[model samples]
Every structure is written in C-alpha cells, then in structure tokens.
Target chain A: MLTKRIIPCLDIDKGRVVKGVNFINIKDAGDPTELAEFYNSEVADELVFLDITATHEGRKTLIDVVKKVSSVVFIPLTVGGGIRTINDMRIMLEAGADKVSLNSSAIKNSAIITDCSKEFGAQCVVSAIDVKKEGDDWIVYTHGGRNKTNINALEWVKNVEELGAGEILLTSMDKDGSNNGYDNELLEKVNNIVNIPVIASGGAGSLKHLYEALKFGKADAILAASICHFGILSIKEVKNYLIKNKINIRL
Target chain B: MPDISILNTKSANFHSVKKAIDLYNKQNIITSDINEINNSKGLIIPGVSSTDTVMQNIKDLNLEKIILDFYSSGKPILCICVGMQILFENSEEGVKPGLGIIEGSVKKIPKLKNKFKVPHMGWNQLELVKESEIFKGISTNTNFYFVHSYFCDPLDEEIIIGKTNYSIQMCAAIQKNNLLAVQFHPEKSGKDGLKIYENFNKMIS
Candidate 1:
C-alpha cells in the first residue's frame, strides 16, 4: 500500500531558502542545499522548493540550487514557481527535479499542461491550484494568490486532470499561513473529483492539523511550510504522530 | 573504474541514478554508447517518460541490438519503471513493440472503486514473494518511491521477486537470470533505495 507523504515546502528567493529555518544543525538557513540535506537526514518523504522570485536570474539560481540539492539528497525533489514553458520544465527536470509544479502558468495556458505532460510525461507535471473560499464557491487565485480568476476551483481541477496532470497540489489561500488548519471541506471536494493524488497545502500549524488533512481531507500527501520551517515540528515527529494515529505514513 | 553503465535514453532521468550510485562510493558511466554499455559489468535503465518514445529513441540510436546482445551475454541488467515496461513484449500506453526480453505485456493499473489512484504515486511497501540479490540488505515491507501508471504482468511468474499492493497486488520486481527490472524507482526511494543500488553494485562486483 502507498503511504501518505509528508513534504516540507521551502520558499526560495533568488536561489536561497527564504524562511528562517530554526534547525540547529543548519548553519545557513537561507541555503536550500543545507536545508534539503537536513530534511533528508530527518527522513522527509519529499521536499518542495518554490522559487518565490519569479525572474530569469532567479530561475537560473533555482536550477543551480536544484542541481546542488539533487547531488546530496536522495529522495524526490519538486521545484515550482515561475515555470511557464516546456523549456522551463525541462531545465528543472534536467537539473534533477523529479516533478515540476505549475501554478499561475497553468491557469494562464491550460494547453501548457498538455504540452508539458506530452514532452515529460504526465507524472512529471503537477498542477498547483490556489483556491479561496468565496460565499458558496471556491474561486481560483493566480500570480501568487494576488489576482483572482473567475475560474471555479472544483471545475478547474477536473479540467487539469483531463489535460494530463498527474497530481494536484491544492492550497487554501484563506488558510494559508493562518496556522489554524487545512480547508478539509475544500480538499474533500477536490479529492472527490480528481482521480490523481491530491496534496493538501496551507494552514498547517500542528501535527494534528496534518493528520486531519490526510484523514479527513482524504489527501494523499501533506505539504507543510511554516510548521517545518519554524522548527515547530520535525519531519520524523510528524511521521511518528501520523503513524501512532494509524495513518500509513513514510518513516 | 565504473562497473555499471546507466543508459541515457534522453527521456529518462539519469542524474538520480548516478546520485544513488555515488552514495555508495561506486562509479557509474551514463552513456548511450553501445560499446560502453556492452563493456560494463552491469547496466541500469532508469525510469520516467513513455515507453514509445524511449523505444523509438533506442531503435533510432540502434541501441536495441546492443541491449539484446548485453541481455544474451548474461551480465546483470537492471531496468526501472518505463525501462522495465520496455523489457516486456508491448504496452497499452503505446503502440511500439517492447524489447521483448521478458515475456509479458504492460497493462494499466486497474482502478479500484476509487480507492486507488493512477500513476501509483508516492512511497509504498514492498512485499517480497521470492528471494533475489537485488533485494539483499532490504527488509520486507520497506517503502520505496513509485510513479508509474502501468504494471508488468510476466507470463512466467517464477521470475517474480517482489510485489506491492496499491489497489491490487502487482509485480514490483522481477528477475529472469541476469536481467532484473523493477516497477519502482529505487534512486528516488530514499535509504532503502540506496540499499538496492548498493546490493546491485555488490552483485556486479
């Protein structure tokens, strides 16, 4: 049986990890390679590096970071942010990324998902959807959640899967960085519609929150940023909690 | 000196395999050169991409004959994911005939009442059915990373070594003489994954 994956998401800016990682072993918190090595040692099931700096130079820096991290870390590494073209996906995959997550770019051009999936296989393409709850419906947000599109989140997810996306990374913008919990309602709705694996992101405060996301939200994986970056919980600690709760997690 | 040669299929990810080999202080040469691959003691065909494109590239580069020659030579050859799929006769994912080195056809993982997802993504525990050198030092139920839509169904079940349950019990690893192939990607499977490479290295040595 496949185990639930616990992934640590690192926000990268100009090639450096942006968050203040409180791990004692890490000397340079800004260095993605160091944080990656630390997470690998801590038994993180997977690592995600999102380049918040969406620039040409920033993309180059992210590639260099990916190359360095891939050399040290053995587990799967997913690089996202600023990935607009098939060439961009190629650059990251060739640099050592197992998968590339498409957010704003995918929304702008749904055809890119099909093109990327054809070129690098659907398993290599991940459609990242940022959704915000509006009155009765979930609305899709783009450009780092600054601009809202009329696209309905539920409908978009189904379309993306048909477009050949292997997986969906659903983030609840309202719950993002709030540390309350994940939008299990939103997750449950999306997970029910898509056949591919759903990774629940945003609003992860404690281990219990992660567990709820997986157990209640029916998410195949949990992508946490603040909880891990601030050292509130280590990957092992989270895994242990999930295991004790009878959730099948990778240790 | 590198004892293992990883084929650069142009579609598959070779860096991960190289990194896995490097972790054990072993050297590996990534090349599509027929002579280099044939000369190596062991060869690994890493995973990723569709089988049609991979096979087309293999035939285009004329590596098919060399691969057959290597297989017939009885030297250890490890094929991963799509690499493993191409070892069979053919697949539903593509129209191209496989290497036909192994007697089986690649079939899509059956959907199980919405309980199982396609691509069989993420880490899953291995259920060892038969003993094989590739699984040495690895315990049963050890989790390994897997990302594939189709699974291999061998005509000769005797060659089956490992099985994993996603929605159904499918062949995870198969060994036929010196040719060993897995539906999972060990290079991305963490510590246990490295152990697989280490074990394969030991076999070659």
Candidate 2:
C-alpha cells in the first residue's frame, strides 16, 4: 500500500536556514545541510526547502545549498519560492531537487505550468496555491500570501491539474503559523475535485492535526515547519503516532 | 576500482545516482559514450522524462546498441523508473519501441474503483517476491520513493523480484540475469534507498 508522507519544510535565506531552529542537539542550527541530515536520521519521508532569499545572489546561494543538501541527504527534495522561470526550474532540478514548486509565477503566467510540465514530466511541476477563507469561499493569495487574487482556490487547483501540474501544494493563509491545524474543509473540497495528489501545508500543530488532514482532509502528504523547527516534535514521533492511528506512514 | 557508468539520456537526472554511488566511495561517470559504458563494471539508466523522449535520445546518441552490448557482457545494469519502462518491448506512453531486453509491456496504472491518483507518487513499500542481490541489505516491505503513471508488466513472472501496491499489486523491481530494473528511484529513497545502491556497488565489485 502507498504510505502517507511526512515532510519537514526549511526556510532558506542566502544559503542559510533562516528560521531560528532551537534544537540543542543540532551543532549548527543555521546550516541547511545539517538540518536536512537531522531530518534524514529522523526518517522524514521528504524535505521541502523554501528559498526565502530575495536577491539574485541569494538565489545562487540557494542553488548551491540545494546541491550541497541533496548530496548529503538521499531522500526526495522539493524546492520552492522565487522560482519564476523555466530556467529556474531546470537549474533546481539539475541541482538535484526532485520537484519544483511554483506559486506566484504560476498565477501570473499559468502557461509556465504547462511548459515546465511538457519539458520536464508533470511529476516535476508542483503547483503551490496559497489561500485564505473569505465569505464561505477560499480566495487565492500571491506575493508570499499578502496579495489576493480574484481567482477562486478550488477553481485554480482544477486549472493547474489540467495545466499538467503533477501535484498540488495547498497552503491555507488563515491557518498558516496559527498552530491550530490544517483547514480540513478546504482540503476535503480540493481533494475531491482534483485527481492528482494534494500536499497539505501550514498550521500543523500536533500529530492529531496531521492525522485530521490525511483522514478528513484526505491529504497525501503533510508539510510542517514551525513544529519541527522548534524541536517540539520530531518526524519519527509523528510517523509513530500516525502508525498507531492505523495511518499507513513511512516509518 | 569499479567504474559505474550512468547513461546520459539528456533528460534523466544522473547526478542523484552519481551522488548515491559517491557515498559508498565509488566513482560514477555520467556519459553517452558507447565505449565508456561498455567498459564500465556496471551501467545505470536513471529516471525522469517520458518513454518516447528517452528512447529517442538513446537512439540518437547511438547508446541503445551499446546498452545491449553491455548487457551481453554480463556486467550488472540497473534501470530505474522510465529506464525500467523502456526495458520492455513497447509502452502505452510512447509510439517508439523499447530495447526488448525484457519480455514485457509498459502500461498505464489501471484506475481503481476508489479512484487512487494516476501518477502513484510519494513513498511506498516494496513487497519482495524472491531474494536478489539488489535488495541484500534492505528489509522486506521497505518504502521507496516512486513517481510514475505507467508501470511495467513482465510477460515472465519469474523475473519479478519485488512488487508494490498502489491500488493493485504492481511490479516494482525485476531481475533477469545481469539486468536489474526497478520502478522506484533508489537514490531518492533515503537511507534504505542508498542501501540499494550500496548493494549494487557490492554486486559489481
């Protein structure tokens, strides 16, 4: 049977892990490669490195960081943030990233999703949609979840899947950083509408929350950042909990 | 010093395979050179890309004949994902013919009654059917990273060494003499994945 994936997300800036990871056992908390190695030992199914770096030089640093991290860790890696063009996706894939997540660029020029998927297989393209609930409907947000778009979240997900995106990385802006849980309502609706895999992102506070996303929301994977970064929960612990709950998790 | 050569299909990600081999202190060369591949102790056909494109690239580079030549040499050759798909005679994904090294056909994963996704993406466990050197250190039912819509259905069931279930039991790995092919990406499958490469490295050595 296919196992549910547990992913640890890292925010990288200028080749350094920006999020203040306060794990005492970690010798270098800022080193992205070191953190990735830690996750590997913890049995993380996958890793997502969100490049929070803004400048061109930072992008270059992120690429180098990707190469370095991929060389050290053997698991699948997904890189997102500031990936604007096909060339950017190519560079990241060549640097050993298994998948590239496109957010704002995909919204601005949806053709990029088709083109990238055509050049590289649809499996390489990940359509990342950031949404916030409004008036009983979820609205898509861009520009790092600050600016809102007129496009409806459910509709955009359907469009991306049709556009050849292999998977959907759905993040709820309202639930993001809230430590509450995933927006199960949004996840349930989107999962029902799309045929591709949906990765639930943002607001993963506990093991039960991750379970809810997979059980109620029907997410194929869960992306957690704050909980893992602050040493509150390890990937192994989460997998164990999921296993005990009869969830088919990769342990 | 054993030399492992990764065939450069132009579309495949050879770096991850190379890196995996590098961890075991073995040297891997990424090349389209027929002579280099023929001379290596082992050859790895990595994944990523459609079957048609990969076949066309191999034919264009004239590496297809060399691959067969290497296989005849009886030195181990490992094919991964799309690489595994092309080992068969034909595929539902492309019009081009496969290398025909293995008697099988690549078909799209059939949709289940419950509607499991087409591209069986993410981590999945391998159900070993028979013992093989490729999975020497890896335990049974160990999860490996997979991302594909099509799967290989071998005409010879005896060749199958591993199977995985998405909606149904699919052939995940096969072994026919010196030729070993898997539908999963060992290089992207974490520690257990690396163990596969390590086992392969030991086999060739």
Candidate 3:
C-alpha cells in the first residue's frame, strides 16, 4: 500500500527560511539544508522549498540550496515559487530537485504545463492552485494571492491535470494561516474530479484535521507549514496520532 | 578504475541516485561514455520517465550493446524504475521495443475503477520474497519510494525477489545472477533506502 505522505513546507526568500521557525534544533534556523536534514530525520516524507526570491542572485542561491540539501537529504525535494520558464525549471531539476511546483506561471501560460510535462515528465510537474471561496464556489488567485483570476478552482484543477500536471497542490487562501482546518469540501470535490494525487494545504490546526483531509477529503498528501514551523506539534507526534487513528503513515 | 558508473539515461533525474551512492563510495561517476562504464566495477542505470522516452534516449545513446555486454560480463548492474522496465522486451506505455535483456513485458497499472492513482507515487512497503545482496540490512515490509505507472511483468517469476502491493500484488525487486533491479527508488527512501546502496557498494568491494 502507498502510504499517505506528510510534508513540511519551508518558505524561502533569497535562499533563507522566511519565518523565524525554531522547529528543528539546528544552529541556523534560516538554513534550508539544516532544516531539510532535520525534517528528514523527523520522517518527513518530502520537503518543499517555496523560494520567494525575486532577484537573479537569489535564484542562483536556490540552486545551490537544492544541490547542498539534495546531496545530504536523500528524499524527494520540490522547489517552487518564481519558476516561470522551462529554463528556470531545467536549472532547478539539473541541480537535483526531483519536482518543481508551478503556480502563477501555470496560470499565465497553460501551455507551460504541457511543455514542462513533455520535457520533464508529468511526475515532475506540480500544479499549485491558490483559492478563496466566493459565493458558492472557490476562485483561483495568482501573484501570490494578490491577483484574482476569474478561473474557478474546480475547473482549473481539471484543466491542469488534463494539461499533464502530475498532481494538484490545492491551498485554500481562506483557511491558510487560519488554523481552522483544511477545506475538506473543496479537496473532496477536486479528488472526485481528477485521478491524480491531490495535496491538501492550508489550515491544518490539529491532528484530527490532518486525518479529515486524508480520510474524509480523500487527499493523497498534506502540505503543512505553520503547524510544524511554529512548533505547535512535531512531525513525530503527528505521525503517532495518525497511526493511532489507523492511518497508513510511513512508520 | 571507477567503482561504479551511473549510466546517463537522460531520464531527467539521476543525481539523487548518484548522491545516495556517494554516501557509501564516492568513486561513482554519472557518465555516457561506454569505455568508463565498461571499466567500472559496477553499473547503475537510474531512470525517471516514460518507457518510450527512456528507450528513445537509450537507443539514441546506443547503450543497448554496452549494457548487454556488461550484463554478460557478470559485472553487477542495478536498474531502477523505468530502468528496470527497459530490461524487458516491451512496454504498454510506449511503442518502442525494450532492450529485451530480460524476457518480459511492461503493462499499465489498471484503473480498477480509479481506486488508486496511475503512477504509484509514494512510499510503499517492500515484501521480500527472496534474499539478495542488494537488501543486505533491509527487512521485509520496509517502505521505499516508488514513482511509476507501468510495472514490469517479467515472464520469469522465479527471478522476483521483492513484491509490493498497490493496485495488485506486483513485482518490486528482481535478481538474476549479478543483475539486480527494483521498481522503487531507494535513493529517495531515506535512511533505510541508503542501506541498499551500502550493500551494493559492499558487493563491489
């Protein structure tokens, strides 16, 4: 049986961890490699380095980060944020990143999805969608949640998958950082529509919420940040809780 | 002489495999040169792509003869994921014929009413059916990272050493003399996964 993955997402800016997170007992909390090694020890299925760096130098630093971390951390590593072109993706993939998450670029040019998928295979392409509930359904938001698009969340997910995205990283903007819980309804709907894996992000306040996302929402994986970053709960504790509840976690 | 030559399959990713092997012995080199690979004590063909793409690259690089020559020379070869699939005669995912080093066919994972994803992309347990030097310290039912849609249906069931369950009871690892191949990526399987590389290195020494 394929075990449900528990992933910890690290926000990176210019190759440094964004938040003052002290989750791991490393000397440098901002160091991406150290945090990655710590998480790998904690049995994190995979690690996500969301590079928010805008400058070219910062992106170069990200490549170095990927190289250093991948050399030590022998788990699947995903680098996202600021990946706009095939060249950007090739640079990261060549540097040892197993996968690259496409957010804004995927929306702006839907062809990039097919191009990346064809050039690098679908498994290497992750379609990240940021959404906020409006009226009866959710709407897609780009530019790091600043620009609103008229695209419907459910419809866009299907489109990306059809365009050859291996998986969908659905983050509910309404629930993100809210600590309320994941949008199980939205997750279930997306899961129902597509056959690919769907990673539930946003509002994971408790272990029960994680359980709900996988069990009720039928999510294949969970992308968590604040819960693990702020030291609210350790990954081991989350695994223990998930195991006790009969969840198939990598133990 | 190079300890091991990681075959450049041009499958988009193999550095993780190289880095994993580096922990045990840094003498490995990722190369496409036939002479270097032929001189190495061991060979690892790591791949992550469709059968068609990997096969196309393998054909373009003209690696079939060298791989077959190395196999016949009794130098241990480790094939991973699509690398493992390429050993068979053909695959359902693509039109290109495989190297046919191993007599078998690669079949697509059935949807089964969409109970599981096409690409079995995650950590799954390995049930060892037979002992091999590759899994020296690894235990049965150990989890390993796997990412592929088509599973190899080798005609010789006796060669299978490991089995993992996803859509059905499928072949995960196989051993035929000095050749060892696995559908799962031990490089991305973390600590336990690293043991496989260590064991392979020890086999070389």
lDDT of 1 by residue, B17-124 (tens): 888887764668989887788778999998689999999989888889888989899889999999999999999999999999889899999998988889899999
Our tally of clashes for model 3 stands at 0
Clashing pairs in 1: none
The DockQ-based CAPRI class assigned to model 3 is high
Local accuracy of candidate 3 as per-residue lDDT tens digits, A1-251: 88999999988888889774575477788888888988898999999999887578888888999999999998899999989999999989989899999999989999999999999889999999999999999999998899999999999999998999998899999999888889999999999999899999999999999999999999999997989888888889999999999889997
| iRMS, model 2 (angstroms) | 1.0
What DockQ, on C-alphas, does every prediction get? 0.85, 0.86, 0.84
Worst 10 residues of 2 chain B by lDDT: B25-34
For every model in order, the fraction of real contacts preserved is 0.86, 0.94, 0.82
CAPRI quality of model 2: high
Any runs in candidate 3 off by more than 4 Å, and if so which? none
lDDT digits (tens) for residues B28-119 of candidate 3 = 99998998999999999998878889888888999989999999999899999888999999999999999998899999888888889877
Model 2 chain A poorest ten-residue lDDT run: A16-25
Superpose all Cα atoms of candidate 1 onto the true structure and report the RMSD in Å to 1 decimal. 1.3
